[model samples]
Target: MTTDLLSLKARWADLRQQQPQSRIRDAAQQLGVSEAELLVTGLGETVTRLTGDFRELLKQVTSLGYVMALTRNDVLVHERKGVYEKVSFSNHVGLVLGPDIDLRLFMNRWQWGFAVQENGRKSLQFFDPQGQAVHKMYLTDRSDEIAYNRLVTRFQDSQQSTELAILPAAAKEIEKDDTDIDVSGFRHGWLDMKDTHEFFSLLRQYGVGRQQGLRLAPEGHAQLLSMEVLKRIFAEAADRQVSIMVFVSNPGCIQIHTGPVHKLATMGPWFNVLDPTFNLHLNETRVDQVWLTRKPTTDGIVTGLELFDKDGQNVALIFGERKPGKPELTSWRTLVDDITAAAIS
Candidate 1:
């Protein structure tokens, strides 16, 4: 039976040429073959095992370029660059795969579909466990843009549906928590700047000099500075500078370039200490904002000034604050200075 089906399907080349729009049922009727036999021949055993076949097809499609695979259990998609992204069709798991692209496979309860746009963008749409389109996403040239679009689209599409599902809420909460986690970490580091000279020296060593800013790589934002490095910078700042003040605000993620050269790395626990909702718009104005906010503390009485440093092992953040002539200012300065020094060292 399998041999006959293979032969019939193989002969489909000539048959399709003769009857381009012919359905397998129609062909079966004319040939006196049972509709089941014709359908089996047309789709083959692979179609019966949809999950396995889809996985195999994805492996091949990804090899060619980007591919999105959908199955009853899960959805796996990839870009031409070999990034495989996976999302659970069920409520169990969701994952974005590949800094080192790998072949991924999984399961769901219903079959999946994929579509690609003319502009090289890919969209993967899948239903949640509650039959809501929980994963509606667009894959663009930029990762952040893609993620943002996907999040927005999924939220908007699900908004009108009568069947309210918990997945959307879960996803939004996850994103919010991620942002909070990043800000919290940055605040912790920014508040810790004790040793001024050592912090600056470390920055110089790492080629991030004072008065010059560095831009990090887009992907580098996720990488975290080691606690050991943060500790060392604080210790050094405490030793040399009269008053070490660390100001961290708008703690988010960033890809930065340092000095005149555009060396890149994604680094952050960014600080927008003064403002929680500040976004780092890459421009001279934002740079001025940061400097203006920190300058008063560093000018005059604070002889040594340094900001932002990283030894091979850790990143150090240090800056100087003006010494207070008045006892009140002096007392406040000491308190802040000690807090900064202790947190980092």
Candidate 2:
């Protein structure tokens, strides 16, 4: 169906009046349009098309003092509140390293940008070619409003069209049968894993995808788990004050949260970490599979709880926080052991 801006604006107004608290992304889906398309319709009113160099603009975000960086996929939203510090870029890869506002950006996937205002709230939102939000920066009361205005004015796209061209979602890679892989070689590589980073290369060498690799691994290496495992892991970590790393990614970027998470709740289809500096809203309903995976690393056996969606896309990765030259945390390893034993029993 074709989208008409005037009609869509009217429809959006009616919908907003009916459900004042719904998010724009949700409302856009309900209206059968892309979220970026919906935001484009507000071009002259509440949205300003942004242009100039995205990288340059990102480099200057540090001037804003304190802001919130948000990245998500279909099932998870990761938000970090702090100043954008230590910004650097190498080709299409970008990094924001600091105690807060950490990010890994595949810069080339950033396709669209907008400066939006609603009910006196403002933010800089960016999207990929397929209309998936790659990242967002929101100004807080402590942020430098003057810096934000300067950057917006400097980079405002000359076109500012009220129409958007959103590409369709890419098809998922087809899963391969275990019989298609060299089982003996795959097993040998699994046994030889010297670090978590080596798993990717092993998958490449075995001509298999990540999920396929797990499925093909020997029974003792990877075991499928129930959704209940996630709930218990969070509760157990909170109770024990364990620092864990939660990795969530989009096609264009991966956002990592490292520290202790205590405020966790599940409401309807969403699992939330309603913390002060970091917030994660994960969609438990979209979860299709959970795997308790043990990978051999130079440090020792590294265990992680991996969640996958129906399309086989990794939804989230949960691992105990540990640096190089250290074995997995004893408590986390014990928790994994107990969970695995319980699942088997």
Best by TM-score: 2
Clashes of 2: 0
Candidate 2: regions farther than 4 A off: 1-3
lDDT of 2 at 222: 93
Per-residue lDDT of 169-236 in model 1, one digit per residue for the tens?
Answer: 12311112222233333333323433333434433333442332222212221123333333343344
lDDT of predicted model 1: 0.31
In model 2, what is the error at residue 336, expressed in angstroms? 2.2
**Each prediction's number of clashing residue pairs:** 40, 0
Task: Output the number of the lDDT-best candidate.
Answer: 2
